[model samples]
Target: MPLLEISGLTQRFGGLQALTDFSCRLEEGELVGLIGPNGAGKTTVFNIVSGFYKPSAGQVVFAGRETNGLKPHRITALGMARTFQNIRLWHDMTVLDNVRLARSAWLGYGLWSAVLRTPGYFRAEKAIEKRARDVLEMMALTHYADEFPKNLPYGLQRRVELARALAGNPRLLLLDEPAAGLNSADADDLIRLIRWLHDEFKLTIWMIEHQMKVVMSLCQRLTVIDFGRVIASGLPQEVRNSPEVIKAYLGDDTL
Candidate 1:
């Protein structure tokens, strides 16, 4: 079965329809891109899949199970995780703490176990710390573990967010505008890091990004949406060459 399958997803915000009849699937170990102009409904799909919003109509199946109404935390526990367009790390939390919190949600331990500090809780805490530290190290952010996200450079802050997502050991990862607000150097680093993580952990990543360089370099396939509808879907170069895609993106300067 596909790692993720979204079928006929439609979202309506009162009178505004954010998405309509959108369907996509990600096979295991694939890297895919979802792109579109501003207000093009890319984020809406991510939001719905991540359980932030219930779709007006459609089904989301992950690993062969329907996930339309599952909570975000429950989905994470099921081996899916996502990062946001904006950095969503807690400014007051240390980098390690941020990572730990994410892993904590999916770790094995009852609420009472934690409250009582049972042996199971201690074991679970140890597991969470080890997983968090390992992810930070893999992302090359170990030295900044004790630092606050607010103090890190933009690139490192982005890495911390990625580390938090990785701490859960997700099989399917959704990245929303990961390269936003970065310099060329940082963007290049992000491209390399994402590629390495995909290969190293065998992760299936689906991203929504406007930065053409990042998308073209990292994605194996590209899906383009315009005004909440799919306009193109194919190989990266093929989609880039599509007349409809070029028109939607308004020429190659952004494509």
Candidate 2:
């Protein structure tokens, strides 16, 4: 079975049909890319799959289970994690706290245990801390552990969000424009980092990225969308040369 499968998804907000009969699937340990022009409903698909929105029609089957209206937290518990295009860090907390909190779903302690500071609570807390620190070390963000995410540069803040998602130990990772708002140098670094993480962790990654260089360097397959419908789906090189795909991104100077 596919690790994640979204079938015949249709979403409508009042009268605006953001997505129409959209469908896609991700196999285990594959790196897939979803590319399109602005307002092509790419982010809407991610939001639905990640449980932020309940689609008007269709099913989201992850790991062979149906997850139509499940809450986002429940989806996270099912080994799915995602990052946003914009940084969504906690400005009040330290970087370590931001990453450590992602592991809260596995604490396995009740309110009474937390209030009384029981052994189980302590152990879980310690484990979460160690996991956070280890992930930070692995991602080379150890030096900023004590600092606030709001105080870091944009690139490092993006790394913090990625680290938080990884701390969840996910089987499926959804990245919404991971290379957005990055310079040429930083974009290259992001491409290499994403490639390394995919191979090292054996993760099933699906990302929505507009930067052709980033997607071409990292994705094995590409899915193109225009006006809430798929225009082309094929290998990266083929999709780039597809007439329909080129037309979809025609006037965009960013490509």
Candidate 3:
């Protein structure tokens, strides 16, 4: 079965249609790319799937469960996790603390127990720390776990976001422009890490990436959207050669 399925999804903001009848599917353990020019509604689609925005019409079935209109937290509890376009780390917290916060969702402790530091709370905290440590190591950020987000380089900060998302134990991961502001070397590392995580964690990944290099190299399938609709969907090379995709990007000089 497909890990994700979207059919006839639409969203409108006033008179402007942000997404119109957008539909797509992702299979188990698949790594797919969502690419489009600026204002193509790529992020809008992500928002709908991640439960940040409700679709005006249609269904978002994830893991065979209808997810439309679900709150973001409820969607997350269903084994879906996402990273934002902008880094959302707690700038004041240490890297370990930031990721530990993500693991808190699964920690079995109540507010009173945590505040009182009961034996159960201590055990949960320890287990959370261990899981957070494992995630940091997986992302190769173990050495910098003690550093604050502001102290790390931009590339490492992005990795920290990935670590936090993974800390949630998601079956499906959505990344919005994971390589947005990185140098060539950093982008390359990000691509490798994404591929590595998919295999190691048995994850299905769906990402919105404008970096052609990263998208082409990392994704097994590609979906291109323009003007809030799918323009092309196929293998990377096929989508890259598509005239509509070329014009979509070419028409917008800023893309």
Clash count, one per candidate = 0, 0, 0
Q: What is the C-alpha RMSD of each candidate to the true structure, in Å?
A: 2.4, 2.4, 2.3
Off by over 4 Å in 1: 251-255
Question: How does residue 233 of candidate 3 score in lDDT?
Answer: 98
- Pairing residues by index, what is the TM-score of model 1? 0.96
Worst 10 residues of 2 by lDDT: 246-255
Instruction: Give the C-alpha miss distance for residue 100 in model 1, angstroms.
Output: 0.4
Q: Local distance difference test, per candidate? A: 0.92, 0.93, 0.92
Off by over 4 Å in 3: 252-255
**Among these predicted structures, which one has the highest TM-score?**
2
Off by over 4 Å in 2: 251-255
lDDT, candidate 2, residue 86?
89
- Model 3 lDDT per residue over 1-255, tens place: 798999998999999999989999999999999999988999999999999998899899999999987898888988998899988899999999999998755879999997899999999999999999999887888999999999888888999999999999999999999999999999988988998998888899999998989998999999999889999999999999988888888874555
Q: Kindly give the stretch of ten consecutive residues in candidate 1 with the minimal lDDT sum.
A: 246-255
Query: Tens-digit lDDT track for model 2 on 1-255?
Result: 999998999999999998988989999999999999999999999999999999999889999999999999999999999999988999899999999999977877889999999999998888999999999998999999999999999999999999999999999999999989999999999988899999999999999998889999899999998888988998999999998888787765565
Best by lDDT: 2
